[model samples]
Target: MAIGYQSLFNDNDSVDKANTHKIYDVIIVGSGVSGSFMAKELVDAGLDVLLLEAGEFFSRTNFPKKEIDANSKLYWSGGIEFNKSADLAFLRPKVVGGGSIVNQALLDRFDDMALDSFKEQSGVSFFTKESMQPWYEKAESEIHQEVIPKEHRNKNAEIFAKGFEENNYLYDSLTRAQKNCAYEEGNDCIECLSGCRRDSKQSTLITTLKSAINNGLHMKSLFEVKNIVHKTDEVRVDGIHLKREYESFRAKKLVLASGAMGNSKLLLNSGFKKSLPALGQNFYSHPQFMVLGLFKEQINSGNGPFQALKSADPNFRRKGFKLENVFAPPVGISMLLPGHGEEHQQLMKKISHMACIEVAIRDTNPGSIKTNRHGKMIIDKKLNEEDKKRKNAGIEAINNIFSSQGAQRIIEGNLPIGLHLMGGLGIGERARFSVVTPDFHLHGYKNIFAADSSIFPNAPGINPSLTIMALTKMAASKVFR
Candidate 1:
């Protein structure tokens, strides 16, 4: 009950949304990568900013040490949400930092192909690689990014590299938003994937949010925003405290960076369905599943950098998928392996001798997110025939790599889990399905904007945190300019 508040410095009530009297110049919904960056930029530019988060605020000092506790406290539905068909699970963060807090910290720029696709879909020239390059650099400069050196790779990563090299498959070290760590000596980077007890991961919670708070940004966590009434002059945000009591705030400008699902749900709940018919349409989540190889020797896959190597092959990109060396903790990985009872326990016992690879599909078949009358979010995502083919191809490639390394057996994850959630209030030319214009403005509303992955026209087959930040920078510049 007392979990979702930020007691920064001596002002314990500073994060209380009701404590403020004057209308803020800008109210940022969600404190993830996009909102955090936007909040920092606006506050530094002498604008009064208020950030409202539905989840609790947590620091590295008080973050959950165990993965189970982390899942329950920091993630939505304990990080085990599923689709309508119950075949896929989606991992969404419910904490202040959002996805940045729970993600693997892979920081990659959008390639030319992805940029060109965005331009073609949204008809926005600024979406091109040439124009967005400086914004990407600006986003990267705000966070610490380093390539995982060969010396820092664990045996699991080494095995992946060995197979890729022997098989002549294109692969390279991944660039992650991480500080120097002792992962090579087996420091266990699994904690970073959960809640990051080490503080080595460069999430916006510790970087942009900290800087914004220092520059007079008021952030209230545990406040679920349910409605946003677009008025002639100001936007009224109606939210309820964790206690289920009603509270409201007014802002001259409202920025919706509450993620793809969150933004869609809010707009639908706010009675804007008629004006914004595309509120929950064009949703995408890069569907991902893992393939594990059973090796004779103990690889201790859980003891080091979880994702150190990634396939750089152009063929896979052409096929609309990508592969990366990835692993998870006991609870996370166990869900991927099939079977139960003695059979499942036996595989769990051999987890230390397993090497893992993840296949993330850039799904062409877009999905939809709808909310029932009772306000429950319904996610509908299914793999089309093309997606199935690409997934099969990725699995075969993983099998080839593991077999080249002399794997005794290969295990494929049957159920897909989506870590990257994008689109909902997509930007495009003004029409029936365009929630936002090319300027990132809500179609019918003047002072409302979207800066998160919710506005992505399509999914880019890479980690989207950096791109989200870059998009935030571009959106914020439009505001200040």
Candidate 2:
């Protein structure tokens, strides 16, 4: 089971015209984490489900290890998309598995504090810890998560953990959604971000989507959905296929799981802008920046699990940011390396000895996602004064951590980048102020639901994949109930 892009389904490559005329029980847009799980749930309930993905499907065997090739094939905007402010850049997935396809696979469950903020902002009681615990368990089971063992810690993780232990900062082994890769047998996790060449990471591609496909799910890859309209009985979705031809789909129920930006852009282009006033509002990216530690000893950060260590202190989390061990491939690491010309080359030479960590800021300030006249997405986000102070605080914390580790020098990332994109079609009290109702139903539209991070009321600073999966599972259950 290599982490290639092989289509395991019978009709994964093209649209199945056999059922194009028949109204599907449910049409789920975006075959990523939420859509994949929702499709599984619906199909398991005996509902006919059709899953649409905007990206081309590649086989696992074709998963590229090169950063350039991977970014071109797996990421949106060729991995260089940014917000209107230009201060924040985003790396988002455009593949079938979405962020799960290229993320570090960290699988932390949302803490009570994070959920408390959501409940407070949205007045949604089900956000309570007790209420969502079962959903988390179910998602954990589906993804096959486990804490990275001590022996599997690479030199990069060792240096990161040493920094925490020496500074008396509580740190713990990270639990990730991954399968055993037998690292001792020469298998490495460096390629996980590029699609896990060993097939060890439990992305939706190998977990939920694969299971759904096996259970008779209909997936139409390379089908970019443009607009969706709610009519008298069923919903209509129009889009272009891979062949540059128009395609239309109809369903009794529709789910928008095409991420925060994707979902908002679609709704805006479909002429539902006024009806869903909050469609592209309330966007947050959990502003993140990296700190690299230059060690005298070879850390070989690129050879081991990309993110195997994380801060365990509740106080640190309360301060609006968390530190997690991180590593990047050659090309990515080179770009993050400071200096230019020969100076940059000198740092690139030390790539093997560099250990990195990212400080993910929990942004409370809201942003908006808009579409230009041509229908291209235009994300506008800014760090408020409070967010600025927090950014400085998080950076100082990272410096302290590296100082404790006896690093020769520290390099702060020149660019502030975020991978977690949330909000936009938030679930809350007001229809004019929020895009979806508390139950994830899009306002003014019957049987249309948003089952992704787009509906998140606020930013959850931690890795959001696990939380998204749990929330979608709960939403799917409610849909059928």
Candidate 3:
């Protein structure tokens, strides 16, 4: 059976071509964290599922090694999409495994503060720690997780820990979704950020999606859904294949697991805005800014684990920001590092001596996603005064950390990167404020559902990938049962 981009054009009888004619039990759009997990559950229950992805699929053997290649191939808008004002750049993944394939794999569950705020904003009863513990446990059991051993901590992590201690702040080791990272064998976690070639990151591609495929889940990559038509009994999905050929598929049920912007744009383009009034509002991205600390001695942050510690300070949490010890590839760092001409060249020369921390703000102001007259996505997101204050506080904390470690200079990144894209299709009891229901169904559609970050009601002020998986598990059990 042909399954990738090239398979869409095959003249001979292919599984994809044959499957298009028969209505599936469920057709899931976007093979990301939510889609992959949901497909696994449904397929395990013996359902005929078809998972369609707009991006290409890649195995460990074919994963891109170079930073530039991975950015262009694994991400949407070539690794940097901007809002209307262009102040914030969004790094949205467009691969089969979505953000899971490219992220650092930090797997922290939401705390009481996060869950409380979610319940307040969303009015969903299941956002509590008690109600969600079982689902979180279920999601955790599906993947391998480990805390980064202290012996594996690199100079960057040491600097972060020392700074936190000096400033009387709390910090903790990060739990990552991985198995055998082989750090003792001289393996660097920095290289896996683009897409894990060693299969240690435990992305959906290597976990849920692989299991789903074994359980009779069918996947077709490079098949973008341009429009969706809902009939009384079935939903019809139509789109372009590899941006060239037209194709359509029918299913009894439809699931949209695309990210915030993708889901909003698709629904708007398909003319569902009339019925779904709150289709593209309340969007949040945990906007992050990197601050680089230059030291006289070499840090060699890229040589070992790229990230190992995260802010666990209650004061910082109350201040609505979190700090993380992080380092990026040269290509990504160059974009964040400020300057031009000889100044930029000198900074690049000192890359080995620089350590970095990022400030991730829990933005209070919500952005909105919309489609223009030409059907192009227009993202309007900005940092309000409260969000700006939170960012400044985080940056000040980072500067203090850098100074305590005898840093010569501190430079903040010129741009904010929106890594955790959420909301837009928020889940709430009322239709006026949300798109998806607490049960994970679309407002007026019986068989259409969404279970992803797009259904987030507000920013959780923490890593959201693990919660996305847990919520999908809850959704699958509630909706499919």
Cα lDDT listed for each candidate: 0.84, 0.82, 0.89
lDDT (10s digit) by residue, model 2, range 1-481: 1223344554443234325687988899998788888888887888888998887565466777678899888887777798887878898788878787788888888888889988888877888889989999888888777788888788878877887887778999898888887778877776877787666888887888877877778778778999898986799899988759888889998999999989999999998887777789999988888889999998887775667888888777878888888877777777687789999999999888888988889987999999989998998899998888778877887788888888899999888887888998988877877788877788877689987989988898888888889989988976766
Error of 3 at 346 (Å): 1.1
The local lDDT score (0 to 100) that residue 93 gets in candidate 3 is 90
Q: In candidate 1, what are the lDDT values of residues 1-481, reduced to their tens digit?
A: 2342343233434455444457888889998889899988898889888899988888776788788888888887766788899988888888888888888889889999898898888877787888999999888889998898777687789888998888888998899888866665557777887667667888887788878877778888889899998889888898987858788899899999899989998998888888888888888899997999999999987776767899999998999889998888888888888998999999999999999999999888888989899888998888999989989989988999999999999999767888899998988886586788888788878799998999987787778889999989888976655
> Which segments of candidate 2 are over 4 A away from where they belong?
1-18
TM-score of model 3 (CA atoms): 0.97
- Which regions of candidate 1 fall more than 4 Å away from where they truly are? 1-13, 17-20, 184-186
**TM-scores of all candidate predictions against the true structure:** 0.96, 0.96, 0.97
Give me the candidate number with maximum lDDT.
3
How many clashes show up in model 3? 0
Model 3: worst 10 consecutive residues (lDDT sum) = 6-15
Q: How many residue pairs clash in each candidate?
A: 0, 8, 0
